[model samples]
Target: MYHYTDFDRQFIHQRAAQYRDQLERNLRGELKDDEFRPLRLQNGWYVQRYAPMLRVAVPYGELSSRQLRVLSKIARDYDQPSAAVYAHASATQAELGTPHLPVGHGHFSTRQNVQFNWIPLDKSADVMDLLAKVDLHGIQTSGNCIRNITSDALAGIAPDEDIDPRPYAEIMRQWSTLHPEFAHLPRKFKIAITGAEEDRAATAWHDVGLHLRRNALGQIGFKVLVGGGMGRTPVIASTLREFLPWDQILNYLEAVVRVYNRFGRRDNLYKARIKILVKAEGQRFVDEVEAEFAQIVAHDGGQHTIPQAELARVSKHFLPPALVQPAQAATTNIAFEFTDKEAADYQRWLHQNVHAHKNPALRAVTLSFKRLGFAPGDATADQLCAAADLADRFSAGEVRVTHEQNLLLPWVQATDLPALWLAARSLGVAKANIGLLTDMITCPGGDFCALANARSIPLAAGIAERYQDLDELFDIGPVDLHISGCMNSCGHHHTGHIGVLGVDKDGREWYQVSLGGSDGSSLSGEAVPGKVIGPSFAASEVTDVVEALLDTYRAQRLAGEPFIASVRRLGLAPFKQAANAVRHETRDGGQVLHVHLSTVDAATD
Candidate 1:
């Protein structure tokens, strides 16, 4: 874990003191709500449904054991002992759990980013004091600020990475932390860096997604994507700079943020993301902004220069784990032991859950959260603590939160599988259905989020319940059933193999189903939904519809065909027909059409 420098310490101390004064004034009613809103927001405080929520930036989801302990302590001391901890990019509260005290502290993988929900307004200063002592601060966690600079969690360790991205991420973090030049942006901005060949950083879904790559000259550089984001209007980022030199990253990013800060919309909150700005201004305008910033950087060589000394300094902090000599191959490992009974199971999990590591003997294991009945991406406090323990015991005392809302033990020894699996099973984190139909990425709809049109958690729960048999689920193969409450696409419904987006039709909730969406480097984004089905079905009906669609696809598909590939090949007509046929056949008949009477009766009830 990177420690804060004196400069970092000074900056946070000053910010905390400033916020403390502001908070005191607000309590004294000297500052009105309107006046205090931005101040609190700048400090990562949001006035949510129940109480003020504080988001503590974790900076790329890499947490040391000590940091995890601090978070656990924060939850136990300040909130309820059972306060939930969720992985980043998981669904909101409505999709996860009931409203409660010590509200959940979600791991916003942005795990790199840390946020705290339900921080008592009066106790916020105390919370800050506690965080400050531990070298953690919420300086640029929120507001119209360059929020936490996110990077690929597997940046350095992934086998196919071009270079370690943590050092650059750290550089960006330092440069952007309370940056004076563009703090007052028209909207919040986000930046992501990924050195991995895989787009683990959700590069297409950020304001700036930097893919570290090498040019023809063989010098390490970045492939920069800009203005990509998700909100009301979702757009995949477009390439802004191809192969920007390593030294120019900060200057270029500053230029980009500065342009958005000056030109992004502030009057309309809904249209305030950088994507909207880019869309309105056109790519050419964005190019001009970059050009302007580049000129500035060129003029002030002192500010933008990447000093060799600084690079060396930052690199030392993010140095890869010392390489160890190859250990003897364990032919009698867990995989061999479970070859007959669990081999097939383990193979499926290995294919989807395990990631290639920089070291051949080591592998990164993904703990899938998509279980039979639990909401996707959810873990109770006990589960979280257990995960922390697992990381400590088995994975070199570090843990990572994936963008898919799952935990990753990035450095698990290949030989420790059996014990780790048993321990994980004890904690309810041992589901082996990573990337299978059961491994869904869903959002919390209507339940806790004010933005949802319908409840998505129940929908996911219903689906999981329908396919409770693991054998049946595994047979279905790689199926992604992503459901989102609204068009905001937080659940990434647009990228599911079978995407379901909840919509409110009049007063009744309905679902729109799309096919062939995927979130990966080669093929990202899905086609628009071909069929809008149901004015909301009963839980059983929803499952039946999904089953019918799956059956239809299975019946018509070729061997070795994935759901998305089959859908793409066969088109959505068969699936749509199957879904509608089931819905129509299942619809209750001979029901009286007394709309006025029903309305009155419903109101009375």
Candidate 2:
């Protein structure tokens, strides 16, 4: 919601121009691939499996309708590979048993970023120019530097928010964007913040997590958690500080990142995360960070300390944008009347997708991008434009990209919910499946990412195709079913109640299933990594394995217990047995391995 100043506009345009020159030099052969690699990464361009991937940052998941339209334009005009590349990709997909690989579409990522997988590297400069015109860029969205700063999607508008975190996030954005000090750290760094009591942002899974809250005297400050991350090692962040005055947040962050820069591993890419360092050093790491903070305040004079005037300047930009509502808008319950079947569907959507806003007259509504045919989070260019149109009509020209890979209209007038729902339903995005099993968080695995060991999209598709009945989903209840291509955790599989991870075994695709992971929600209880059930299963058995796990839960759970609660209550023994029971071996002449409880538990253990 922050409007760009003239200086900001000029700065972005110059960056675009600079990138154009660099791209030109690289294309002319003056800059070699190795020389151009870091420069291209600085601008958020990556050479993925088949084509270039552009990661466009939606700052704290906020986007204007104008920006959305620009994104739609990019998807329509430029999100395509060359004919030869397309032909080869199609052939590859055909071999993989997936025909019609899509083009001219975009994916919403778990970190609240938008990704275009078909953009050509040669045409990237032109795309950068278009992004500059709309005050959007992908800078700091990639590379080993600090990536996008993420926060709760309902930052300022949440009913339980203690303070609007957008201002702080914006300030940090300005402070960290291309900082010479942290331009190249050991590995990618991430920070997530939340102001609400409920942990919607999954702050505990970030490298640096901040909780904006008040002390006993009502003085605002931050509860800082450091070294939390997911990869080979999943770690809940250690508390760096119980409370640091809000004014010194920037200063404290400086100290924390400075320590990581000095000590974090640079030799091995696999063990380079701050989580690894924190785990290895333990208390020593905490002592080092505190000492660094003391040094920054004493010797550095806390140059990054935020002044009240500066904070106010940023805070005013995030105030509710102009939203006009009916004079007598319904504040209690929706007043829409419908026939029996119609009313049942509308009530399901209202209960699942509509969320309370701080303003009594406004509501936040999520447009479900999870449906049949298309992969989760994949939206075509036409759908993007349609979403922009819906935002313009209902949300005061603003839309939010949520961490769940869906678009949220944060300014929907409470009384206009009926009309908005009708329009969204027409777009086929009103599945009323928010938090349900079908609303999975998935990544474009081996299909697009070169780093992926196996494909994630088709697995997600298979599961979705199997569970089309709304009654079944409602019965299963809220569960985070996250899938990832590899250890990068792009789809955040480690935090899912039922985690699906794609891996490569003997040059063939295999999947490992994990259970009981939580993302630190009130429903999840705490942020914890899931435990593996048993040996990796063949791709053919994954769906059956999931069915077996769910079946075990269904048979054993107490009345009305959610899937995650059941998995927690009855340890992993029953689920592991269930998962292995139906797992038919595809290797060694298709022999079946009968698994007993002792062998199953021992295999996983």
Candidate whose lDDT is highest: 2
Give the 10-residue window scoring lowest on summed lDDT in candidate 2.
Answer: 596-605
lDDT for model 1, please: 0.68
Lowest lDDT 10-residue stretch of candidate 1: 596-605
For candidate 2, list the clashing residue pairs, or say none: none
lDDT of 2 by residue, 307-379 (tens): 9999999989887867764354456356667778767888899889999888878889999999888889989
* Candidate 1 error regions (>4 Å): 13-18, 81-119, 326-351, 372-374, 506-508, 522-541, 586-605
Which residues of candidate 2, in runs, are more than 4 Å off? 324-337, 585-605
TM-score on alpha carbons, each prediction: 0.85, 0.95
